[model samples]
Target: MKIKDLFKNKEVTLSFEVFPPKTDDGYEAVEKAAARIAELKPDFMSVTYGAGGGTSKNTGNIAADLQDKYGVPVLAHLTCVSSTRDLVREVVKSYREKGIENIMALRGDIPKEGRIAFDYNHATELIYDIKSLDESFCIGGACYPEGHVECERQSEDIIHLKEKVDAGCDFLTTQMFFDNSTLYQFLYRIREKGIEVPVVPGIMPITNKRQVARSVALSGSTIPQKMKIMVDRFADDPEKLKEAGIIYASDQIIDLISNGVSHIHVYSMNKPDIAEGIMRNLSTIIR
Candidate 1:
């Protein structure tokens, strides 16, 4: 099913994301994890693409499995920054053959080695390419609630977002955010700017103390003082930290849904326990 259709449903929507493994040896374990999460029966599940081709091949395989074997609709992520046009086409064509219709198009992170030469400089270019190749595709794009780390200003970031939408993005999934107010403000700004596509907020359940620092460094999502205090208090207790993290993420989702944000996506980290905890918390609310 197209994600846009899922977004249109009256009941709030929830989805989970899982990534392909970096090496072949770990493939079975990751697939097992994906299966466990699928058992939670989220509105849909997304398979993440790796940075390079080696791991990326597994993306299609996993997405296909989720859709065909597990009977869940899949959103297959496609990254274009480090790939040539031909390579991008090949990946998209492979996905189409798998009967996967939804795609999360991304510019992807530049590798540390920094291969400067590229056929696609931005996600908008890739969105345009995907649409040109197959108009039937339901393409989703990524957005930053607190502004992109690379962009100096939130206003500039929204402008780029509008450009991406104009390039044929069907909807957007936000980068994970800790504070709800930041996303609320971003929604107001984007709506005021005339970019009205449905934006699904991404939530990450921080189960580890080290994750707090790493998440901020990666996505620039501000860690609220409340969350900070909780982390500080429970950082030493792994079980406590994990329980608190799941509750915190559930609270974030409840608030978003109460305020009429209908769709949410969780970066499940391929952890079925976290996904199940969140789903159990929302059992009455989402259905």
Candidate 2:
């Protein structure tokens, strides 16, 4: 099932994201994570491509395995930061051959220690090229609800997002945000600017206190004070903290659905427990 069709109905849908493992020893574990997530029966599952498109092969493998063996629709991430034109073509064709039809096109971050090379900079160009190569693919693009970190302003970021939508992007997924108000404001901003494509709200529950710091540093998204108090209370006990974090994420997701944002994606970070906990909490609501 292409994600575009899934979102077209604008039905309440839940999805999970996973990533490929870097080492052979980690492969089994990561693959197991994918399998466990599949058991939860999300509408679809997405596997992440590593920085500079390094894990693309593994991404394809995992996605194909889930779709082929488990009958789950798999979305593969294809980053273009370091891939040449030929590489992009080959990757898309490989996905087609594997019978995978959905893709999350991305402009991955440049690696710090190695030489960076690529034929594209923004994800929009990659979106254009992918559409040209495979018209049937349901292309997904990333949107920053708080505005892109590198953008001059939110207005500028929406302008760039308009380009991607105009380039045949089927849907857009936002960067993870803790506060519902930020996303609601961003929705207003984008719709006002004529970029009204379906936006899947990306939710990241602060499962770990450490993730909160890193997530803010990476995306510059604000951490709300209410969540800060929750974290501060349970930050010491591992079990209590995990439970608190899952509940926090559940609340955010529930609020999103209540506001009629039907499509939601979890930045699960390959944690089945975290993802499962959130799903467990939402089972009644999502039902």
Candidate 3:
């Protein structure tokens, strides 16, 4: 099902994201994790594209499995920074052939070695290409609550986001954010700027001490003092930290729903245990 239509019919929607294995050896483990999460039956599940398309085939395979075997709707991610125009079209066609209906188009992170291809520089261009191939696909683009790390100013970032939406993005999903107030402010600014599509806030459950630095470094998300305190208190015990992290993320989601943000996307990675913990926390609210 197209995500836009899902939003129209449901008052609240919750989704999870899983990534393809980085190498062939781990493919079965990752697929098993995705299957377990799919059993939870979120409104939909999104399969992330690996950096530089290293795991692109696994992405399609996992997405197809989620949709066909588990009966879960899937959103397959496609990145264009490291791919050519023909490659992008081929991936889109492959998705269509597998019955995938939604795509999250992105101008992926530049590789450590440097970009290999320049066929597409911005996500807007990728969105355009996806639409040109088939307007029937529902495309989702990324947004930043604290502004994109590469962009110096939040205003400029929103301008680019508007252009992305104008290109053909059906909806926007934000990078993971720790504070709900940040998203509330971002929503106000985007709405005032006339970008009115449904914005789904992506939530990341920081289950361990190591994830804190890595996630913050990658996303540029500000860790509030309260979050710091939680980490400081529980950092020593893995189980305690995991529990605290789940609670922290669940609290964030409840606040978002309370404030009338109905759709949520959790960056569940490949940990079925963490995904299940979150669903257990929101059993009554999501229903």
Candidate 4:
């Protein structure tokens, strides 16, 4: 099923994201984790592309298995940076053969060695390539609620976002955000720019102390004062921090739904425990 269709319903949609393991030896454990999350029966699940397509085959394999074995619709991510256009075509073709209908197109993180022979500089170019290969595929793009870390201004970010939507992006999902207000303001600003595609807010459940700085550094999502207080208070206790983090994310989802943002995607971080906790908390609200 196309993720775009999932949003057409009156009730809210809740989705989860899982990533393939980096190495072959790690695949089995990740597969088991994905299976456990699938048991929650989310509206859909997305499999992330590995850096530089290092785990592309595993991405396709796991995504196919999710749909085939667990009865979940899969959105396989495809990153264009660090790859040639031919590689993108080849990956898309494999995804189609594996019964994958949705893709989250990303520009991806530049390698530590820096940009080297990248065929596409931006995600918009990748979006165009995906559409040109197969118009039937539902292509989703990423947006930043607090503006992209690289882009200096939010206004410029929105303009670039509009360009992606115009290029045939089926929907947009935000980078993980800690504060709901940031997303609310971004939604207003983007709509004013005339980019009206369905925008699903991405929520990351911060289960441990390490994820805190890494997430902030990557997305530049402002951590609210209350959230910081929670982390500071519970950071030492692993179990307590996990519980608090889940509740915090659940609150964010409930608030989004209350404000009429029906579609919410959780960056599950390949942990079924976190996904299950959030789903259990949202049982009555999402259903």
TM-score of model 1 (CA atoms): 0.98
* lDDT string, candidate 4, 1-287, tens digits: 88888778646988999999999999999999999999999999999998778899999999999999989988999998888988899999999999899999999988888876569999999998988898999999999998998899889999999999999998999999888888899999999999989999999999898999999888888888998999999989999999999999999999999999989999998899999999989989988
RMSD, one per candidate, in order: 0.9, 1.3, 0.7, 0.9
Q: Against the true structure, whose lDDT is highest?
A: 3
Error of 4 at 173 (Å): 0.5
Candidate 2 lands at a TM-score of 0.96
How many residue pairs clash in all the candidates, one count each? 0, 0, 0, 0
lDDT of 3 by residue, 196-218 (tens): 89999999999899898999899
The numbered model that scores best in TM-score is 3
lDDT of candidate 3 at residue 84, scale 0 to 100: 91
Candidate 1 structure quality by residue, lDDT tens digits, 1-287:
99888787646889999999999999999999999999888889999998765677899999999999989999999998888899989999999999999999999998889865489889999999999999999999999998898999989999999999999988999999988988999999999999989999999999899999999989888999999999999999999999999999999999999999979899999999999999999978988
RMSD value for candidate 2: 1.3
Q: How far is candidate 1 from the true structure (C-alpha RMSD, Å)?
A: 0.9
What C-alpha lDDT, on a 0 to 100 scale, does residue 150 get in candidate 1? 91
Estimated TM-score per prediction? 0.98, 0.96, 0.99, 0.98
Where is the poorest 10-residue window by lDDT in model 1? 48-57
The CA lDDT at 74 in model 2 is 84
Query: Deviation in angstroms for 12 in model 1?
Result: 0.7
Q: Candidate 3: where is the Cα deviation over 4 Å?
A: none
Badly placed stretches (over 4 Å) of model 2 are none
Ranking by lDDT: 3, 1, 4, 2
Task: Tell me the spans in candidate 1 whose CA falls farther than 4 Å from its real position.
Answer: none
lDDT score, candidate 4, position 260? 94
